[model samples]
Target chain A: MQAQLIALDWGTSSLRAYKLGPAGAVLEQRSLACGIMHLPIEPRDIAGIYCTNGFELAFDTACGDWLDAQPGLPVIACGMVGSAQGWSEAAYRNTPVDVASLGQALHCVRSLRGVDVHIVPGVIEQVGLPNVMRGEETQVVGVLQGLGTQVLIGLPGSHSKWVEVIEGRITHFDTFMTGELFAVLSKHSILGRTQQPCDQFQAEAFDRGVQVALSKDGQRGVLSTLFSARTLGLTAELSPDQQPDYLSGLLIGHELAGLPDHARHKPIILVGAAPLCARYQRALALCGFAHVSLAQEATERGLWQLAVAAGLTQPVTEA
Target chain B: MQAQLIALDWGTSSLRAYKLGPAGAVLEQRSLACGIMHLPIEPRDIAGIYCTNGFELAFDTACGDWLDAQPGLPVIACGMVGSAQGWSEAAYRNTPVDVASLGQALHCVRSLRGVDVHIVPGVIEQVGLPNVMRGEETQVVGVLQGLGTQVLIGLPGSHSKWVEVIEGRITHFDTFMTGELFAVLSKHSILGRTQQPCDQFQAEAFDRGVQVALSKDGQRGVLSTLFSARTLGLTAELSPDQQPDYLSGLLIGHELAGLPDHARHKPIILVGAAPLCARYQRALALCGFAHVSLAQEATERGLWQLAVAAGLTQPVTEA
Candidate 1:
């Protein structure tokens, strides 16, 4: 099958390119280290033009070969690659946007290779606390096809995002520093001092942490409960090996606890790395969340849908 | 006035020696950089004995001159100096302890000069979640006199402690890693990337942070609210200089929000650096906490009381 679109998930640390056949089928894929933050800096000739820009260098390295194979392939990219510091700034679109609205708003930046790359605009909510996200909005669009009218989509990563979708439109969302906080605390704070790395999963310790986050003590909030991570070790209640997972569960539990009460009633969809999504699944179950499911290949499918909606590509026809 | 006792506030990063005269009045004082974590390493002759021990070197450096000037003066020390990692291990005393009990239970470590340094044992609470404190216990003891039967004392610092005292006995207490979290987040996390140092305090931003913590949105918990430190900046709601204070107020607000409901009705006392205490004072006021006040010279005063109670030093007669 001939490729219909080239979808790129270009985030802060990694870039993943997908060659989607008709109907956004995965035909070929490539992973590169050159996200916007880590783009190649060496100058090189591209399309008979001398180029030194990191963005152009990264762009060629990521999909230049695929583009050469089929020069007319429509290119669409998402994530921090379109931030203010990215290849080209894609101004954030306000909330209540879906594939149709955001697809129509793709910011195009022509590459030195003479290929126009359509960058998806991120979503922002300003109702109360200003919440923003670039990449997760695509995943939300990807997974909305078969979900209920009201759904909560959780994209867990360095910065976990919980997006609320009503019908097919993105309404509101929240960003949690849970993953980053856990990383920073485990790597730099006193909590890391006693944490022993382990090969086996400390399920009991993790469950205990989730329970603590839901217990009366957790009502005091994470700032107060965070000390338990260290004190529990001092009291010989948590072994050094169990401390890391315990801290993980505690943070994930707190993140889940922050979800709106209505979220418990909505069908929840999670999209992220398998291990992290599994952790969230466990924590959500512990938190009494009943309707939870995981979604796969969200970014490519969302990018495909947006590409089609924007007339960059056509939907697959019946065989 | 002649020196009656030498009191040392020995903590993790710094040590302070105070000479108290009649009625526990300040006679002389010295500050040393050598805390347990940063003790001096050079070999030196002390009291006719060659010593290479870091603890002995730090001990001599802290107040060897004061001891030489008044060889018979009694000495008492509090804080991390009593931990297992300190110069000598002082077993933690369980909670509901008063000055009399802790005073009588001083753990004595004999120095190279043949002088015994009395170390105050820290307090540990075993109820529900375990909580521990070393130096702050002495401060709690110092500020207990003449207060109401039941009062809450807050020691704001790297690890802020909130103690619930009843009739001069520490009944229950909690520790919040607020100050340390703020430091690590500001220095190491993405939150610090946009923060600009300003000589002037951003009171408005700080107050807004406190309000956000107390607001309905804050009910979601701090792990969720922490993202606002960046989002508020992205939206131009907070300037670079205001970001730091805003984060400070936010964390402090969440810490205060964790306080039990009864804390609002009980008298509250804060002890620490005047500037930090003032920040907490302002936040506490914003949180609707009415009966809040500050205490001064808590560590030194508490050390004096404990020394007198332990019979290490005689009580001064009124002049």
Candidate 2:
């Protein structure tokens, strides 16, 4: 029942910690607003010393007490916490890497609590446009278990990533700015003027948006189709309440359309927030992606697999 | 020379007034920061009457002196002044409308000074996605005078429009939120965080962006290429100063790529701010669009033609 590894999913705005037991099972979990960008700033005492560093303060607040009861728990962290601006820089590892290869490249940062936190290095694809990812790599590593050779993993978020794996190695990937683009367009652009937020999901409008993205007009690309979000409202085709979901569907559709050609024949796996993944699931269905499924607890599982791969923790045999 | 017509080009952010002599020649002109959205709020006396209406105040300020000198001059206005939110709603005229046709449908709003201002109605294309234009319609009408039978007119700005005119009739048109997207992403998104303003145009970066949009990767759409604006910077391939122009070029390139198939074979005319038009010209060349040209004084010229078409002014014989 004792914890074997402490896994931290630290991102730009939020931090999630998991206490994994024998056989890589999640024993306890905690979430904190202590992501690198919003790290704790208040001076706090840690290991008989006043810790002034934001990373140290955040690290202590996130799981300092979890380590108190069991001091020997090996720590593993992923995401922006290993970037250039993280507690300690973990240089990015090139792509065509797997959990085993990435596990060998984990960066180490010693905290004031006398614990060495192993940080997972983000992946960088040097080919083409040079795509980079921080936390999604770990999630991809977690989801690769027992998957076929032709696998397309989608991690949807502010910057949605479509990663293609060939026999457990991430051979190629693409990043789409759909979510962030939608956010900025809705909050700061002229499109925001007419959008009226509604509680009920406007499935019709959302479907219409997805359809439009697949239609010939959508062939013009999103920059052109985006105007339709407002024009449809002006023409009263889409009510105010339907605008947001319509936009969401439209952006997701465009992102789906932008996926590399190899994704079409592959078995797709989606990992992200449930709501966002649900949106992608709907869009993927609309896209006629034959084989698709959603992943649960991807981050913790990926971190656990990575911990085992790194020899930092061993998976216990059950019964 | 005596002024024959008073022409006002009023839009969302600025107003320009012109006193036209015989032959629709500009005799005098003035510009004011009083577009419909930024109308004057200060109450003032107009023709001995204290008026508080924003439209009236803006109208008086833009050309009250010209009207005072010749109160009998016929007045014509165009742009957002005819929008639903303008002085008086000049209901949008359906597309396939020409200058003569639009002039016949001008809506009249009487000012505090007892002068009737004929406002040009904007054009709306209800086909497909329902495109609408307020100010750009006038510019299109202006640029259409001597153009060929087949014309593809591009007016690039906050919302760039491409109007397809066949034998002087606006048969169809499309709108791209390219300019507005560039502005919002540069000002409010994660991409903006790494951008640094530069006085000089990053021509190389701009050209690279355009190329990327036309490349095989660009076939995936801008929602994907947009990530390059940041990844390129992260990889040290694009500097802070180059990011903005690169994004601008990328958006413009995608917009050009979205233009209907018919545009390639026709003569293309661009009407907008000079610098923006120049950027489009560069992008057009990069896009292999050979038949591209720039226009000047499109608004005032279009307003003058419309006024003459309405029998509000006569072309004086040159002596």
Best by TM-score: 1
Error of 2 at B220 (Å): 0.7
Candidate 1, lDDT over the whole model: 0.92
Best by DockQ: 1
- Name every residue pair that clashes in candidate 2: none
Q: Give stretches of model 1 more than 4 Å off.
A: A317-319, B317-319
**lDDT tens digits, residues A153-233, model 2?**
999999999998888888888999988988998899878888988988788888889989988899999988999999898
Q: Tell me how each candidate scores on DockQ against the true complex.
A: 0.89, 0.87
Off by over 4 Å in 2: A317-319, B317-319
| Model 1 Cα lDDT, one tens digit per residue, B1-319 | 6889999999999999999998899988889999999999889999999999998999899889999999998999999999988999999999878756899999999999999999999999999989999999999889988889999999999899999998878899999999999999998898999999899999999999999999988999998889999999999999999999999999999999999999999999999999999999999999999999999999899999999999987787566
* Candidate 1 lDDT score at position A31: 95
Q: Using Cα atoms with residue i matched to residue i, what is each candidate's TM-score against the true structure?
A: 0.98, 0.98
What is candidate 2's DockQ?
0.87
The sequence of per-residue lDDT tens digits that candidate 2 reaches over residues B225-291 is 9999999998999999999999999999999999877788889999989999999999999988889
